[model samples]
Target: MTGWLDVHAHYLTDRYTQACTAAGHHHPDGMPALPAWNPQDALAFMDAAGIAASVLSVSSPGVHFGDDSLGADRAARDLARHVNDFGADLVTSHRSRFGLAASLPLPDIQGALRELDHAYGDLRADAIALKTNYHGRYLSDPAFSPVLTALDAHAAVVTLHPTSPPGWQRTALDRPRPMIEFLFDTTRCVIDLALSGTLARYPRVRWIVPHAGAVLPTLAHRVAFVCDLTGTPADLPTALGNLHYDLAGTPLPVALETLLKLAPPNRLLYGSDYPFTPAPAALQLATALRQSPHLQDATLDLTPDSPGATLFPRLFAQQGRPEDRASPA
Candidate 1:
């Protein structure tokens, strides 16, 4: 099997995690604990899982912790800068094995915009990572228009990852949000993007939806029907055709089968959601995906070239084949 290019991998720097912990995210989004991560460990996982390269992003709880006090914006801005800088350095160190999808400090619009410019301009990120919602401000909110506009201007690859819902306390049922709420949040934000005409407004920006489209495959018709009845701008089927989906989580015969209903084979990309997923579980997922009989029929192209290169040609080369050289000191 060819080495897989994973688009949905995650990274957690010590300072970034420390900030989250200080802000009371001891177990972010109600996970077991903040998983340990480092460049060498990440490369080891890639080698073991047959991943040629991965686009890394700082996952849930994002950069801002919703502190409305004085100097909150400055704090958020500093943390976001730190995260992007750290990610940029990671890319510099392992140009072949990893790419940074710089995280923004959203709900703090000015700060986010600053990071966006730095991310695309200086850091030269492979993509921009945004949570489905920021401090209850969904991507479709008018407040996010500036961010979207800037991203469109750059024709950036924007990855939509899920975070805790505003009502997570009531909705999560005391279980980890990643277990279920994450998928729902992904679906909710995507439907919002379509219905609110967000996708239409940002045609130049390409979006990568994680977790096998996160219930989108199954809800495509239902969403489109509602939009038609309500006279909303949502054309879910058409949008699905345009956007990309990553095989991050348990996208086996079920999710994969349904996802094909809306997207073509080439639009599908591999993702490992690692560290957050725990290496052992991630390995099982990667192994299972490769061995799926149905996937064999799809002729899935897991190579380094095709689709990803078209989006992130700057960082998609097979630079870390041996893995040892790519490992950080």
Candidate 2:
């Protein structure tokens, strides 16, 4: 009933639908218009579930398509603004109950930089959301350094969500993408970043990898060995330590153990990947977290000082209740 924050979610807008159609991409099964996916619906769900805040973000398959870098960049940038403005309006209406994560045009450094400036200066987004891989190239690639560089300059808090690689959807496996591929994508991204020294280069950037860091925790020993073989022992712990993991869509025992072994307690935050994954699941996970014997004495309580205290402690105190705030973040 308290310390609840749903940080991962998707809302479809006209700009996003149009971009999908323009790029010859078929809209997914659940894709719909803005009104159909409004924050009001999320608020209603949160209220019913006893959630205090929900940090919303545009969903995956973010703008990049097969070699359509320029077109994807333009679409992504425009859609980022549209989403941010819409989120700003929602925050104005709902205040602390809702915040936004900005979408970026990845693999296109300049476009990403421009979007970052606009999203921060104008839209006042709480953080940024990025897919693990854009079209097959992982963000850990050196080619994407400029994107990280721009994010570091802005001191952005980024949440890494995952989507299947292009052409892999509806495969013969007959499995929901989230059940199998999303976790793999997240783990792969973490490994790529570790191998590429991304964590070292952009040390200050705060990242939250969803699904409790996917498979990274379970496979850390092997990953560490690989790093050692490659003569980068320092990167193993650095990557494991520097990143945050969101407790969205991951089982409690798995998430709790992963947090315990791979990251600090404070780096483990609450997140419910809503809509696609229901809010009740998060409640169940939180209950399990509270009951975990593996957790230390420090992490037993996840509640904020006030309803909105965890994410925006100072702002909530200064501005009074969350509904009274003017800015989106």
Query: In TM-score terms, which candidate is top?
Result: 1
**lDDT digits (tens) for residues 241-299 of candidate 1:** 78988998888858988888788877878889998888999999888988876565443
Instruction: For residues 34-79, write the lDDT of model 2, one tens digit per residue.
Output: 2246566777777665566677887676655436556656766676
- How many backbone clashes does every candidate have? 0, 0
- Model 2 misplaced regions, further than 4 Å: 14-36, 166-174, 279-322, 325-329
C-alpha lDDT (0 to 100) for residue 150 of candidate 1: 97
lDDT of each: 0.84, 0.67
Q: How far is candidate 2 from the true structure (C-alpha RMSD, Å)?
A: 4.0
Would you give me the overall lDDT of model 1?
0.84
Model 2: weakest 10-residue lDDT segment is 27-36
